[model samples]
Target: MKRYESWGRYPTIRDQKVLTISSRKAPLPLPDDERSVLPYGLGRSYGDSCVNDNNAIIDTSALSNLIAFDPNTGILRAESGVSLATILKVFVPKGWFLPVTPGTKFVTLGGAVANDIHGKNHHRAGTFGRHVSQFGLIRSSGEHLTCSPTSNSDLFRATIGGLGLTGLVTWVEIKLVSIKSPYLDTRTIKFRNLDEFVEVSRENDPVYDYSVSWVDCTTEGDQLGRGLFMAGNFSERRKSRQPKSLSIPFPCQAPSWLLNSYFMRSFNTLYYNKQLSRTVDALTHYEPFFYPLDAILDWNRMYGKRGFFQYQFVVPFDEKGETIKEIFRRITRSKRASFLAVLKTFGDIESPGIMSFPRKGITLALDFPNDGAPTLALMKELDTIVLQAGGSIYPAKDARMSHEAFLASHPRLAEFEPHIDPRFSSSFWRRVRN
Candidate 1:
């Protein structure tokens, strides 16, 4: 038996049976009730959604392969196990880029589809699943399901953002976007409060191709919700530019004291002040802009051996003002440290994924070090605030959300239940399932 854990590095599972499938033709049979199965990608999920503690894990990392590509039309078909990093390496030089990408390039195609992952460009391009044209899935009933907008549509909806509960996705086809250059012309705008962020984001949304912000979650009083906003678009330069090759080499886990409240407050101040000019313009490589944390591998280790929790939630656009301030007020009052706090707006483009997280709203993601009960209590309080505000928490980044909160967040859970493959299950499913 092997061990397994999500990217958060918390709640590690020590007795996992891993099945590695290297090819699509590997006639792998589905698991039965004696042992439920879950398709495991790169295990980049921040929570337990990608893990199955009681059964087996079908490791798809070995199945990475590029099945087909049409450089002229920018449509590519590849195995579900293929990583975004691999795709960028091959296509970026050819002037193509993913229509939507999360904060990390190490995630698998299937995982991206499963979570319906969004990016800074979500306000324009929508989630990753929106660009996926089709895919092939194998279910517990020994049926091969070909899913797309036109074929097996129900299964496709269920599978996307379904958290790998529908079945095992073998391969997928995606529509790539054209890029003039691998660099972006970007601007940074600092905001002092939630109202300023909302106003600035609205003003920049129509003009910029991408937008996001870094909020100071620890700040309170007049400085509450203070942050640095960034907006960018692909540069007109047609020249191909490769991303710089830099990675953190086997860094040791940091001590808990390294990221205490005092340190984080000081860090946020420095980071926010770093952008001296109100709006500085620069040309930057897409790698750093899209995946800044990727430069430091194992950066999660900085949270210490106890690991951390990534709490991400979205409230309707109308609730952008007061609700956000209340959230910040509560966080500041609790004095919990959230080192990485990002805020962004989602466009009105609705995803086909039945359980997809993003919608037309404002999202805030925070990383909090696990301090046991106190942290759980804080999250519960946040959950209440979000639910009351007609918002939803992201399951992909949650490890301790209650069943009531899950049901509240996903009002269509009943409709999605019928599509789940009986033989597929996950720690997250069990925890939140009715």
Candidate 2:
């Protein structure tokens, strides 16, 4: 079997046919002879779900365009290849925003559906799949189909987290939330240790619509897992100016070792304490609050020439989010510290996409600088802790999980496998098909 690589250090790609599609109305390419087709969005997925071995990969970024939007209901209909960045460019200033968004706005509508991404407000709204109304797709049989809750419900659910296995998502209609302003009223808080942060977070979450924390990965012992917490809601600006276009300003990369042992601690110290020294801030645009790290543009370059791995896994709420603490401590003790460790609460979401990865719990995501084999081994062990906690890793953020571990974590594997076209398969699809 040929191997498919990832954005980080994963290597090998031998059997992939890469095709780019444009924004104009064009018929999808497929022959009765082919087994299946996988739609590739912005190629932002960190790993191989969008990749396959010796098979067709239909790139859809060129086909992006806004189709329609219902101003009254805040519902948006757009082609599958259209990106979130394009939506915000036109809508934020117009008083509407995506209900749930990942860190980057570069993802396409079809990509969001395939990954079913969750945002900081996951505790209140769930994942991106929950906010979607319906999507247009081309199945493996060369037939076009539309899936949604009331229509092809199973196929719809299957496609949400289906990893592009059900078919190629061609377009989507989503419901956006209209806001009073394009600003955020943010509150930043700090915790002395991981234990305290988790405790305080649990207390604060019942009331806030959006909440997330950043941890100090370098500290140990009593201060192990210490971090900063930021919570916010839409700013109540009596009147809001139309939001500005996102400017890259200067395109640059994170300084090498920006998150290394020494540098990371100092950075965390300053950021966490900034909360106390600051006052009620004036109105800030939604761009900074909802996507602070994204401002850097291509910030992933910070990991250096070797690249990095973002390990994000959801640990289900067995007893009110306590397992999360154990996982955090394990990760820090292993010494695989990243720049930040994000922990947040998630609400009950109804996605039966056989591979859907969310539940009532807290998620912890950390990055690993690919120093070498040692780092990879450490992350593999960390995967075990997540599995034991009855959790599943986010495929969009994972590039190194083994198929055995994936199936063990998500027992609902069979539901998605049947839809695959046997003749057309991916390294990622083949790995877990057993």
Candidate 3:
């Protein structure tokens, strides 16, 4: 048996049987015993949504093969196992790019659909599912489905952001956006607090094609949400020589104590002031702007062998952001600093996936080292605030959200339950359902 873990590497499971799908037309594989099965992509999901504990995982990586591409319409059809990195490498040079992309390009096409992943430009492009024209789903009952807006529409919505429970995503056909060059005209602005961050976002989100912020979670009081706001649009300048992409491994697991609050405070301070100027503008490669963390391979090891947890929740825009401030205050008070904190505003555009995480709201994501009970307690407290504020947590990045929390966050759960395939289940599904 091979050990498989999510990106977070928490709640580890060591007894899963791996099954590989080598062809798009292959039959759905199952465990010899009673254990359930779930589709496994690149394992880019930060939590257990991609894991089926003590069961079987159908590895879809081998199904990677570009089936078709129409440069004239900016549509590309490929096997679900294809990574965003592969798509960019193949189509970017031809003046086409993913219609929507998350922070990392390491995710598989099927994973993107399953999570309904959103990008910095979500205010405009919406979630990745929005750009998916259609896909092929293989169910445990030996049913091959062609899902889209017009055909098998219920399954289409359910499969998108459905956490791979509906079935195996065999192929995906997504619409791409045209780009003049593989570079972005970017502007970086410094903000002193959450208020300034919101103001900057309001002013820039409509003007730019992409926007996101990096917050310093160690600060408190008046500096509680100090961070940098980054906005960009695909540059129109003639394409220049693409820089050589580089990947540096993290080398080894860092000691857990290395990411303590004291260290995080100092690191955050230095990172915040690195720009020096309040505002800076430049032309940057899409690789760094969209996926800076990808440059550091196996970077999750930085959180140490115990692993880490990513807490991401979104409060509705109707709340006027008071909820977000309160959550920030609670995090700061806990003195549990998160070195990797991101804040972004989702636009009013809704996704077709009934279970999609993003909505019109303010979403904040933070990474906390797994310090056992203390970290779990803090997350529970934060969950209380988010649930009270009528917010939902992103299942894609969750490891331990409660059943009540899941139900409260997703009112459409009752509607989605009927669509789940009987033979499809996951560690996350079992946890939240119980």
Candidate 4:
């Protein structure tokens, strides 16, 4: 038995059987005996969704391999274990990039599809699953099913954002977007309040391919919601300035005192004011713009040994700007420090993922250091606010959401249960279901 923890490092798991796969021809059949299992990837999920405690997991990291690529059509097929970092190393030099990518590039292709990850460009390109053409799913029933929009359509939709419950994805084919350079024509816009954020998002969403904002949740009153909005697009140049990849090792977790509210408030002020220019335009490398935190290895250690909770939820785009403000107000009143609060808008493009988190709305993500019961209580309050506003919390980043909240957010949950593979399950599934 081996111990494993997801990216968040909360609710640490132990005594689980791990089956590491290194061969493409490895046979994976559903356990004939009465036991549960799930496919495990890069362990990028922030919560327990990827964890199956006391059960078993098939580690797919070593299955990384590029199966094929078509330069003319920009379609690439690779093993499910292939990381986005590997894809960038091999394809970015050839002027191709992923159609949609999350904040980090260390995630596996299978993980991306399972999470149906949305990015800064979600308003334009949709979730990562939208660009996936097909994949080979190995079921415990000894069936290797080819899933796509036109083939095994139900399974395709279910597997995308399905949380790896449908089956084990062995290989996948994705349609990559063509790029002239690995740089972005970036712009930063400063907004004083939540109202201005809505205005700027509305104005920029039509013109820019990407948009995201850093919100200061600590601020209250007139200065509330003050932050910087960043928008960018691929540069027209044929060559991008290659920046050397550097990593900073985090050998140990920081002390809890280091992540307190006072310190976080100061950091928020500095980050928001760091952008002196209300509007600044520059040709920036994609690395800094898309994956700034990736440069720091094991950055999660900064949260301390107790770990942290990443609360992400989306509210309707209608006249619910005040609802969003109320959420921030609640956070400020709680005096809970959330240093990493991000705000973005989701587009109308619906993903085929039955359990996909993104919808046409305004999404807010905040990271709060886990203070045990108090932290969980704060999340519960946030959940009430989201539910009242007719919104939903993201399951990929969730760990302690109530079963009632899950059903409230995902009305389609009843429909999804029928598609779940009986042989596969996870800690998250058990928590929400039981």
- Top candidate (TM-score): 3
Please give, for residues 175-288, the per-residue lDDT of candidate 2 as tens digits.
Answer: 999888877777777778766776777887776677888877767677776777778788776554645656563355455565666676677677666666422344567777
For each candidate, what is the lDDT? Answer: 0.88, 0.73, 0.92, 0.88
- Return whichever of 3 and 4 wins on TM-score: 3
Sort by lDDT, top down from the best: 3, 4, 1, 2
Predicted structure 4: lDDT:
0.88
Question: 1 or 3: which has the higher lDDT?
Answer: 3
In candidate 1, where is summed lDDT lowest over 10 consecutive residues?
25-34
For model 1, how does the per-residue alpha-carbon lDDT over 11-84 read when each residue is reduced to its tens digit? 77767677777688665655444788899988889988989886888999777889999988889999999999
Q: After superposition, how far is residue 418 of candidate 3 from its true place, in Å?
A: 0.8
- Tens-place lDDT per residue, model 4, 218-325, is 888888888999999999975644878788878788998888788988999999898787898988899989998999888889989898889999999767488898
Root-mean-square deviation per candidate? 1.6, 3.5, 1.2, 1.5
Candidate 4 Cα deviation (angstroms), residue 427? 0.2
Worst-scoring 10-residue span by lDDT in model 3: 316-325
lDDT value, residue 323 of candidate 3: 88
TM-score, one value per model: 0.97, 0.89, 0.98, 0.97
State how far residue 373 of model 1 sits from its true place (Å).
0.5
Instruction: Evaluate residue 318 in candidate 3 and report its C-alpha lDDT on the 0 to 100 scale.
Output: 51
TM-score of 3: 0.98
Better by lDDT, candidate 4 or 3? 3
For model 3, residues 236-287, the per-residue Cα lDDT tens digits are 9966799999999999999888887888889899989989899999999999
Q: How many clashes show up per model?
A: 0, 5, 0, 1
